[model samples]
Target: MTAPSAQTDRFVLDRMPPRDQWPAFRYDLPELRFPDQVNIASRLLDEAVENKGWADRPLLRSPQLTLTYAETRERVDRIAGYLINELKLEPGNRVLLRGGNSIGMALSWLAIVKAGLVAVATMPLLRAAELVQVIDKGQPAAAICDARLLSELELAREKRPGMVRHVVHFGSPDDPQDLGALAARQPPLFRACPTAADDIALLAFTSGTTGMPKAVVHTHRDVLAACECWPRHVLKAAPDDVVTGSPPLAFTFGLGGLLVFPMWAGASVYYPDAPYNPETMVRQMREHGVTTCYTAPTFYRQMAPHAKAIGIPTLRHCVSAGEALPDATRQLWKEATGIEMLDGIGATEMFHIFISSAGAEVKRGAIGKVVPGYQAKVVDDEGREVPRGTIGKLAVIGPTGCRYMEDQRQAKYVHEGWNHPGDAFLQDEEDYFHYQARDDDMIITAGYNVGGPEVEDCLLAHPAVAECGVVGKPDEERGMIIKAVVVLKAGQTGDPAMVKALQDHVKSHIAPYKYPREIEFVTVLPRTETGKLQRFRLRQHTP
Candidate 1:
């Protein structure tokens, strides 16, 4: 049963899918328990100083600025005061946040939740059209944006005039509507809203696609539950640990790893002034003494050579998500930096990493066990539990589950009270789950079913291959034929002989029938800004 909500506006509450459509939530873990009325912003920020005794400890840090726990709470309270007193936004109102990963962006997000408003954070790379879709769906009453990324939001507002009434810009000194200026006008202290645990906290939309994204609703309880499960069991972050990552604050992966996880541990996060490349990311980690790093597999792959050349001695925990982690890339990163990569798979639907292993519990090819607070199993098409060693769909349920905002796809995601994330997997006798491919990406040729990731992992082990994506190509002889799109290493040629050698390499490593029958060379692969490979786009490039 859901705790009674304190929000009077009821805008988001009315749009929530019917209670029957919601996935069953479990709070079996002792840490998952929470008070009936809980405010995550207060629980995370204010409690850091009030309860955790981290008043003077550094909370948010960058080369340009550093804010202690008390100072961060002060700024958060001031921004919350501005939103409530100046903008007149009521509880349950949604505020759209736009910016790259920075201290100001973080402050705005925390302030929105603290003010009892739902935060709708958008990716930094979103254009006018994408922003329009977000605006149409979320119907935000106001927006607080980074001044540099304001042009796209301005264009979006032009198309949907009066949709977002109040707009404030941050990161600009000269602008008349600067958020910092307006916020400075408000008092430095404001009492956090007393929100119910079930009240909506944020609306995280799925990215990396052209279609209108689905809005995933997360509550204060959901956010706090995720922090208890993943960070407590898998990450085990320390208070003094300095965290850094490449994911924008918009993505749920970033929200958890970069912001919420750090606050949960009373740790500090370093946000770079500018965007990060392999060179710059390595430099930041080495110079700033970053202890924990969160990024995708592709970024880790690109940074391996750089980390090998320049050491990051303080680095301990490295998290890989946003996409599958190829064992070859994992081996390369481990060889370069002695720290083993903590690979996990999470979705915007589930909020954060639910399947991961760290330290000595790391397995070579599995995505570890179900998180402490969660239960998972591999089930066949009919949603029946598949036998161990059999491949099927992965279903999960815990304190957090799929709760799309009035989307019909809720039925498709939640089946029999479990949240299916659309990934195909197999469970070993020891209960480790091995990822096959995305259910849509599994390739079947001549009655032979092959997992593309297994074949891609095999091809990635070769010396010539730098990056590759495998998919099925429609064929006349067979239903489909395996095709490999590859990006070769520098100084390597992608000629006919090279393709044959790669084919032979895969055939030797795995089943010959699973080898990619056709090979195409490309300079780069299409990927989401968060580093997920767009295999659907790769499959679109047919002969």
Candidate 2:
């Protein structure tokens, strides 16, 4: 690793764990080798312009317009120049990005990276309280946000005055200080920062499903390495492929799938004008000729029916990874599109999917084999490797691993050079990993242990069920009882008979003990913005 330069901003670097505490970062693959001083934005964007074939290829496309690789690079350079010359942002200063999936948001992210600043991209739906948590932790010097989503950030700014010195908005004609206005005044040429490969590139905050969000720091090498692994081996997208997805750019999953992977493959990404629901996603894919997609299982389940009705002919690869991909959902998607959904497991800590399978390598119910650049194992609580087929915590080490920003929880997440991602898994004889549950999500009912996802999968197979969440409810008799909170399908009645039918369905499908002893029907189940079921919320509802 290269030593930090005097010009490099040390805010994030100063907060990172000492060298001895970091998980072992392996660069065994020849492609994973990075230069001492590297700027990922230059590799992903500027280098493409120098290539004959890739220079003119479309990089980012929306309903309104398309940006070629050269065009996108120019815009990135201008924005980066504006940040440095106009806003006086120093290298390593954090820049908060707030926006939905759009060309502007993508440009802002690349600019931040090019400027050698840490990008703290927040979800569009995040409120003032949530924004404050990130602001307090990252202490960003400036924010480049979508104008429409400025209210909450403004509120947060009011609460944390002096933390953020400058604010530039996009998608706002009324605002005189919009990013576009500032960029236009600057020259469209700026030298990429000469930062080290280990220099922090971005601060990816976790969804905070269980507690306050933790900022997962990723280095320039980490981001580049992630692109090399999954996109190179698993996804295998071509230059002509048009990619689209529902995950917001704020999420690492979205950032990789939508922007990074496409640029890495010399492929193009299509961002929709409006947010995509199931129907809209199908329509947009068909209209724009999208060949690759990345979204959650719930969205896939919803889109499967529409895909069957009006086929998405151009779509060849559909990647699912925010939560575990239920077998039922996978089968349904395959039946609908005649294409198997590529399932993978990744965390904010790891940057992108480290375990996944594409094409013929995909197993029926497994989250595929570990990617080429990574290693994983099922380990017991004591960090010893567990026997195959034994449920234990999943530990992983790769080119990109967890580095929390100034958080004590880092010790808990990284132990003895391995990242424990809090999920339990069992590896089979074939070396394929099967997700059981989050260590805390496993339910112990009447002395029988059950994975909540297994019960939810069984319930999802039933025609009457739309969505469901299972949790262990406190009980006086048994230590705990398996309780289910279900959302019925449209026009389906949620009565005693329906509940009994679901219970009976689960009993018939799997072990009888796994069936929910108590079932409560509701209009909807609580979920994160990324479509992960908030099982903790369901547990709170349970007695």
Candidate 3:
């Protein structure tokens, strides 16, 4: 057994069955029973074709263009027809897609599914290093990319001869090489290719538990399950609502929130080429009447100070993820927009959020509960369950688990029949799971272990900080001390007083002992392509 002191703060959950409480935060939908064997695109299109059965209902609305389900499906069908009839593609063939979100991207993605080809969508912001890693791993037969980001492909093409064929901008195809023109010329209405439950649908790469990025292979069931379960359980978005948010499409969070979640429900979605700047994102939200928003806790933190400027009058549901949702940010959103930012935590391996609380169960600081279909527990090193409130590795078991096709990272995460991917979570007696931090993100100093995120959360409550990261830096005296690298709000200067003030603020908000020992104020902190803070990079700058 773990130490009794470790169990002291453990929250006890009721052992017996509790009273059944229907989700008050959700809009009732006909309860769904998912089928065993399925293909994602086939299901998405078929549902809109059948149940939603709405003709020409809007399917996508980007900053560049708006497309209806009829328009999108027809074009995707043609593209699928092109891939099958002309490209000679078959189900399960890997196709690399390199670009940001666009109508063409949306169409190509659908086309891959419609043709039964596996999609390897990458973030546009990924550099050649990450690209080469993915290309070498997947060995895709074909690629589609935007014209602007073509140079990286040029670098990749030198190495990945397998990715010889490339798809560029849609226009009058002068002749043989224009995939866009060919797709446009083909007729819509193609039959769905039969696929098995275990067939690979998407291959997403997220940071490995060992620090290297690992490619996670997800099946038709895993990818589609989140799309279906999310809108049903979390967003409650209908065909009438316009959904939009900021996350690179490569990130599963963005894929689900910005594209799949809305489209799966036959609702419209929008994406802009530029960064999700508060001025532009808020403008689009109001102009398009975007009903649902999903983004990082940091994004919300930045938007909070300019809440009214960002136009929150008609906003309905806003969610925070990619980082913990600080109480200050959540309370600020409610004060500014009359809505709380629902907090959720998920990883790329899980595809999307498997743990989230519906709006009604909103706890100020705790991330909600395990999603209904997913089972979670806090466990010790030996896999035995831990008592409530004791922080331990969070393990998940569900319809989805790791199928790390041809990668050693699989064994590193999926252990002893449990998908325990190095996350730390604390569960309460009420079943609410509080995310502690990533396992490696914990810092030990003078025999005390502190979570990086817990300290970062405290500093973010300061008005001077816009975004922050906490990392353990080498200290000969105390072994290791918490250091905060902070980015200030626009027009704010990093003065001596501000650094001291931030430290003082954290001391007051959290355990005084956990205050950042050193403060380095910078204009920006390094982040992953999908906007997650890269603490590894922050540690390099520590003096």
Q: Put down candidate 1 lDDT per residue, 192-211, tens digits, no spaces.
A: 88899999999999976434
Q: For each predicted model, how many residue pairs clash, with residues at least 3 apart or on different chains?
A: 0, 0, 4
Residue pairs of candidate 2 with colliding backbone atoms: none
- Residue 249 C-alpha lDDT in model 1: 90
Candidate 1 wrongly placed segments (more than 4 Å): 1-3, 174-176, 209-211
Q: Candidate 2 residues 1-543, lDDT tens each?
A: 556652366888889877667898889999998888888898888789985458788999998889999999888999999999988999989999999999999999999999999899999999999899999999999999998999999999999999999998998755677788779878888899988888889999998667678999998889999998999988887888999998889999999999998998899999997655789889989999999999999999999999999999899999999898889999999999999899999999999999999889989879999999999999999999999999899999989898888888889999999998999899999999998889899888878778888888899999888888888998888888899899998899888898789989999999998999999999988888888888888887775
RMSD for each of the candidates: 1.2, 1.3, 9.2
lDDT of each: 0.91, 0.90, 0.72
For candidate 1, the per-residue lDDT at 86 reads: 90
Poorly placed runs, candidate 2 (over 4 Å): 173-176
* TM-score versus the correct structure, for each prediction: 0.98, 0.98, 0.89
Residue 360 lDDT (model 2): 92
